[model samples]
Target: MVTKVVVVVVVVVVVVVVEVVVVVVVLVVVVVAVVVVTAAAAGELVKVEVVVVVVVVVVVVVVVVVVVVVVVVVVVVVVVEI
Candidate 1:
């Protein structure tokens, strides 16, 4: 029973980590593409400011997501151990 539980938890954690990484990568790519396109279409100075703002927001969001994921993984591991 313990082995099974451990295996399941490991699998779940691996999947979650992979999913989070993929999501963050996709979001970054999309955000960069959008920023670049918008900057090209709009005024340079205005769009540069907007891009900077968006990049910062994205960074914050990614950090939050990573922290949340880490917390969840730790909780799961602790629960499984118990």
Candidate 2:
């Protein structure tokens, strides 16, 4: 019967729409997961860079202080000998 065919067609269309919606939802979830992971990795890299910079600065400061101390001691010794 024509009515039976129409009813079957409607059911098929409904199923297709439901399937499409589920696929879209899954895609969204995958995209969100990837973004979160990338952000976390980037944040960690920034933290490491900050730590390395701090260490370099501290080392330079310490070296400069040691050099200044050595120079002062040498100057004092020369002045005393004269």
Can you write out model 2's per-residue Cα lDDT over 9-82, one digit (the tens) per residue?
57556655665565566556655655676588875433545545655665566556556655665565557556
TM-scores of all candidate predictions against the true structure: 0.58, 0.49
On TM-score, the candidate that comes out on top is 1
List CA RMSD, all candidates: 3.5, 36.0
Local accuracy of candidate 1 as per-residue lDDT tens digits, 1-82: 7796778778777867886787778687967787678678676444567667877887787778767877877787778677
Per-residue lDDT value at 54 in model 1: 74
The local lDDT score (0 to 100) that residue 26 gets in candidate 1 is: 65
Worst window of 10 by summed lDDT in candidate 1:
42-51
lDDT of each: 0.75, 0.59
Report the alpha-carbon TM-score of model 2 versus the true structure: 0.49
